[model samples]
Target chain A: MAKVKHHNIPLDQIIKPENIVFKRTKLFTDNVLSYCPGCGHGVAHRLILEVLEEMGIADKTIGIAPVGCSVLAYEFMDIDMQEAAHGRAPALATGIKRTNPDKFVFAYQGDGDLAAIGTAETIHTANRGENITVIFINNGIYGMTGGQMAPTTIYGMKTSTTPYGRDPKQMGHPLKITEIVAQLPGTCYVTRQAVHTPALVRKAKKAIRKAFEYQKQNKGLSFVEIVSNCNSGWKMTPVQAVKWLEENMLPYYPLGDLKDIGLD
Target chain B: MIVGAIVVDTERCKGCELCTQACPFGIISMSEDVNSKGYHYAYLADPYACTGCENCALVCPDTVITVYRMKVEEPSKAKN
Candidate 1:
């Protein structure tokens, strides 16, 4: 006997661009961000807003804002956002997405929030194949707590917690979250990109859109790690921080998609 | 007809070929010359035929292409 199979259509094909793009009434009319001029978080915020606007699901989306620099995301973003404990955004997102399956759910987390105190939550959320988008910003330091050391911190990098530079012998090596998460069977898409330059920023946006696309299709977890720069925390000018990220960090975490399950 | 120049930064070019494929006017083409990274870079063969749509620059993977439109002179203005 022959068996029947089913196919799923992509959301991009179903949703028209006019409906997805943000309307003037839907955008937040706020002043410029207080973040340093070159902070990647600000760019990330704009990209998320653009994605939400383009998807035309701002009203149906729930963003779980994690602790760190983005704690004040609610003030800037027009969408409904719930504050989650440090490193608990993923866990909160999991519950929100599972219960409200129809809504688009996402968690915005920083390196310290996702790789340190929330490692277990991050792993379990991805491992369980939660239908949610995880936007992980790896800036190599804890920006909110005044430049503290983070799991993604590079060797010889000095932070508030590592005043004498990060000693690999004691602090261990930097964590590659994308590589680790890509190994999980539940994860449908895993990518690492940066927003330091316009070219890179475009790629980051595409990766972000793809993650959300996977979530909309109920294709399980999608993790996108952005190599962000914390200019203020790094004690460097915004331009210098962007240059540093492009030269130093890019060599360590080269941008590109690590895995694509091709659910769409 | 006015002609335009299409500049490509070989350093940033990732050779995705999306720009070459997106050009509806078929003015842009990929060159056999490999960049430092051993990837074929994109170039324009027919500048006069460029419609200035900028679809090539918009779709370039590395954002290396820059399309500039040259102003066209009218017959009356040229005579003056």
Candidate 2:
């Protein structure tokens, strides 16, 4: 006699309802954002909020806002925030964490802030193994300052500073920060993520949470670089920005944990 | 046993209408009415058909919607 085969459903589906825990929190204020329709910063912001919520550390969290487009991150995040000078969020966060050892300190910076003017601060912060989380948003251009060329600007990509497109000969190559930070011994957890889609967003959140977890464990420096999209700066619609990020950015900045030292 | 109903934090909702469109079981419908924040909100007219796949929750740009699957126990054979 032939046997019938039955597919088994996931155990999670059969578990108790109370066992379900929110992966993140919803502490973000209900203000309508000023971001462009398809900008990935909004998604990145929500993911950070979720991570803070899941870790139950909103009250203990302190964020350092960068000078670029994301300078206003303090407005969205409900946690205590301090405004840093251009490319100085890492320095500010370093001081905050050093003084307040019990607080969870993080710096939210853009490509221009991380890869350019703030390069020394970011590198030294990671090198010193500061007990802080650095969330870097790489949109490849200076979104707030009118789409100027960022240090991470892709080759052949056009921006205000590179109207004819970024030429390697004159503009030099794009910088890969995750790889750079991964080389430092003081760095504990380093990962790159994107927010172009749901699956990717989920992965990004996991990385963000892991970064925070590292900080919670006092595991030195944790860095999460999000390959974001600047729809308004890139001159693309929201959908187009996502598509462009996938097509153009992912190839250069592949996603995943570049370094996971001391993580259990 | 009924578990919990899905709740939407309308303040974070962007009114993209993707949640309403992504509902596979036709249980979610966009409300003509807006929320306290004034953005259009998605409503669930038929909670029974919701499979709790979280498809709507996953697609929301604002992370506003949440699907809560209630635990339902089958009748105990010996007790019955």
Candidate 3:
């Protein structure tokens, strides 16, 4: 049988109240995602907004966008947002959460911003157990400023800066910042997840929601490390990148909950 | 069984094909035609097979796909 063509049909004529199953959340501005096609950042951004909308705290939430690929997150997220300097999102979130204890606070950061330049701020913030949530995107490279080796770039992984692949002898080892924070007494929840597949997307959303719920209960700092793909930075197509992430990235940065309240 | 349909925002689609990969029924495929962005967007190749599970919209980075599902009414249950 021949397939029906839908490009000629108007969207309104296709969508109706009785059959509508899913619609884009209103928390996201209509600004088309700026990230490269197939990049994980956009999905991560949607998951965060969906959580905010589900929790009924979109108006009461304040997001701190880090100086990385998501620097313009303030423009995309409909809720109130603040842009933080390179690696300073944690520090800013710390201050904001302290001042506005009643509001839900979160910092969205990339690996470079959280593991490289923001190491000091990140550690101290988690150590202090600031009543906030940190959504960390670990794509293992500096995507916005062009592909470069990041602290979380797995050993032997190739980035533009590490063309021949990362060398621990010259570059140093990959940093497990999420695990480091989980050991801190201040942090109440810490987990690692991905959004490349349908099952993982659902799990990632649940992790995001759980992190926010922890913040609402004032349970110290909740950290969610989303091990994601950077298709453009890695010089691979979106589909290829997702496959590479599963084959190469997953073994090193395995997914699952690292720490949770009463879960050890 | 429930029948599903989807509205793809051709202008917004990046042709990533994640939706095609996510469709459990293998009903979605890249279109032969290109949108304004010069990319071959995803389209419902076998719309009748769609179950409206929403996996396509869930993984779409651009948030361009809106899904719909319809439960066909049964004549036997119409009396009730």
Q: Which one is best on TM-score? A: 3
Per-residue lDDT for A38-98 in model 1, tens only? 4677668767777888888888999888899888777777888999999999999989988
In terms of lDDT, the poorest run of 10 residues in model 3 chain B is B70-79
lDDT string for model 1 (B1-76, tens) is: 3334466776556554556655666666778888886767777766545544455664342345556554455545
DockQ (CA atoms), all models: 0.04, 0.16, 0.45
Order of quality (DockQ): 3, 2, 1
Q: Pick the candidate with the highest DockQ.
A: 3
RMSD of each: 13.7, 6.1, 3.7
Task: Please name the candidate that would achieve the greatest lDDT relative to the true structure.
Answer: 3
Question: Who is ahead in lDDT, 1 or 3?
Answer: 3
- What are the TM-scores, per candidate, against the unseen true structure? 0.71, 0.79, 0.93
lDDT of 2 by residue, A50-125 (tens): 8888788999999888898878888888888999999898899889999999999999999999889999999999
Candidate 2 has an lDDT of: 0.78
Q: List where candidate 1 sits over 4 angstroms from the true fold.
A: A1-26, A29-31, B1-80
Q: For candidate 2 chain A, which ten residues in a row score worst on lDDT?
A: A1-10
Clashes found in each candidate (C-alpha, N, C closer than 3 A) = 1, 2, 0
Writing each residue's lDDT as its tens digit, candidate 3 over A144-213 gives 9999999999989999899999999999999999999999999999999999988999999999999999
Candidate 3 clash pair list: none
